[model samples]
Target: MRPAPVVLVSGTETVLADRAIRLLRDTLRAEDPTLEVSDLEAGSYAPGELLTLASPSLFAEPRMIRVDGVEKTSDAFLEEALAYLRSPADDTYLVLRHAGGVRGKKLLDAIRGGLGGGVEIVCAELKRDADKLDFVSAEFAAARRRITGGAQRALVAAFSDDLAELAAACQQLLADTDAEITEATVEKYYGGRVETTAFAVADTAIAGRHGEALGLLRHALASGADPVPMVAAFASKVRTMAKVAGARGGGNQIAAQLGLAPWQVDRARRDLQGWTDEGIGRVIEALADTDAQIKGAGRDPVYALERLVGIVASRGEDQHSPQRTG
Candidate 1:
């Protein structure tokens, strides 16, 4: 298929958006070795700069112009871009990256709807376990390899907090091993790392396993996991549960409304089995105190997190007792 003259990459997922841009550059370079690639930040460029870069060269060589942060672009740049789009140079490929905002909707709509052979590539953020699983599977498939479901879950659990790290892990595994990726493979490569991420701590705490949660929290801190993200994870989980509990629709509908994957909604529903509104409120209050303590409102962040784990695990058990204040 012929490449589009103008490409609009829209999304907040930095990793995916970056991958798309790289793939486009690679494709153009392969087709023409003399392709000239230029990178620009829309928020910092001078007026008429885009037109000058996209203008056909004296030798008429193939060129690819990549402009990032277009959502914060200047009006002058937008006007110049829109004018150039009307009569795009045949040897030029323009790539615009926007991180999902309404700041430049006029230019965005013009590019998306104009007759310049434009293509819109979505790089929506992946917030659900299922979406991350599909990403892992796709990575393996791209390399003509296979990964077991257990292995996929393990990888996601290990690096759930960072998509870029997860992608790097997939690539590293592919490079380091020739066998099909499996749960055993993940354990062999990232066992200690898995125990230290916030998700692991949050998982056990939300399951009401106080002992396991405390142990995991200790291991996580000892292994260099920051206290801030750990508490943030707790906040994230509780917020998701609250959203799911208060939602009025089915899994898919609620997932869409919450920008979550359907499985996440279902998982949150299951996790809310014994949780009461009063219990959730108490846990949220405890988390707030821990958040403050870790950020200097109190002393001993570690103690704060431990107390938080105890409070969260004990949620829905005794509503009358006062929550521990760090």
Candidate 2:
């Protein structure tokens, strides 16, 4: 399809917004190799700049003018943009990049109300694991590459904290290999991220693997992983297990009720086995203390972490048990 005369790329997801802009640029360039591309910073825009770029050249080639930071646009840019929307130029693509603010309300209102007859591309944040998984799948799908379901989930779990990193991981896998992507592939590429390592420690600890959890925790800390997020990982997994502990329903139904992804609900349900409500509550209490200690309430953060691991591994019973004798 031909590019819209005016395009509004709005929202706070920089990765998605940049992808949208690049796709538009690539499409226009393919349609007309002689496409004249120009970039204007709306935040520092000068008067008449948009018109200067949008004006017809002697060669009269197609033009693509991208206006960025529209959410912080100056008054002059705002006025001229509103006017441009009143009459968008022919054979020209005007893309307005807005990262969300109230700075250019009048102009945004005009464009949204059909003053420019433009198409909107909203890049909302990918907050849910399901959404992030969809993003990973689409990235691979766009390249006509294949990725297994387990690989998709593993990638999401590893890079769940950063969309950019997740996207980069996908791109790296796509660029580096030709084989069908699998869970082992994802682990090979991103098994060392702090989020991944932290979650590993959390999983080991929560499953009663006391020695393994301590080993993983120590390795993670030695690898420069912050203690706060390590505790947070435990808190996150245990909290999820707590949320779905007694809930009875299909994964989708329960996930909706708990505001979690279906995969997360399923994983939590699996983690909840052999765990009682009382055990979960005791773990939560230990997590609170460990969180504070890791944040500087105690003398030895490492010891606090070790203690927390032991507590979780014992299903929150280790803390109350008599100390082992030498």
Candidate 3:
């Protein structure tokens, strides 16, 4: 397949955009082993620099030029790029990356409108659970492997905050294991990382599983999870539960009122089971005290965290029990 004279890889999702560019580069290189590759930032180059780079090489070798941050490119650079697009070299492949903005709308439109037979590959951000799940599935599919649904969800939850990290994790799993990816496989590989995450600890504690919560807390700290974020996580969960418990109306309504995702509101409701208003209050109060201590007010932050976890897990049943305190 012949590469397009110009390709616009646009998106706010950096990881996806980067992967698209890499795939394009690899495809080009496979066709021509000596394909020259140049990665440039549009904003960093002066006027006419793009044209200079895209010009036919002295050795007449096939070339791929990747220009990132085109949305922030100067007017002069844009003008030069447009001019080059009008008469693009057959042997040169130009990749323009715009990170979803109005900064270079006109240029984007012109390119998409078919200037130099330009093609656009969009890497839009994956915000929904479905989209993320698709990404995970695609990653596995690329390796000619399949991941169990349970394993996919676990991987997504484990690296929910960072798509790049999620992709890296998926790639690592692919490289490390030849068998089909399963829930147990994901847990075996990422269980330690998941245990240390604040949400994991918070979930166990709020579910009133004292022993499990305490074990998770100890593992988290031992795995280098800081005391401050751990406390903050507990506080956040308690606050959400309190809000959901007190809010009137259906789950969707409460979710909107609290600015939480519907699933989050639903989970909060479940976590509120057997948690009286007084219990919620007590846990929140304990969290506040632990937060301050972890910050600086008291010594032995680790002990403070353990106490907070115990109090939360006990669900106000034994706020001052010797077992809890110890």
Residue range 66-107, candidate 2, lDDT tens digits: 887788788999999888988988889999888787889888
Candidate 1 lDDT over 1-326, as tens digits, reads: 23688999998777787789889998999999999998776766688777788777989999899887688787877878888778898889899888778978887899778657788999888999999999999999999998999999999888875677689899999999999899989989887673337877887888888888888888889978889989988898899999998987544467789998654675677679888999899888888888999999987788788888888888744322234563
Local distance difference test scores for all models: 0.82, 0.84, 0.80
Most TM-score-accurate candidate: 1
Off by over 4 Å in 2: 192-219, 222-326
TM-score of each: 0.64, 0.63, 0.63
Candidate 3 clash pair list: none
The weakest ten consecutive residues by lDDT in model 2 span: 317-326
Residue 306 shift from truth in candidate 3, angstroms: 13
Clashing pairs in 2: none
Span of 10 residues, lowest total lDDT, candidate 1? 317-326
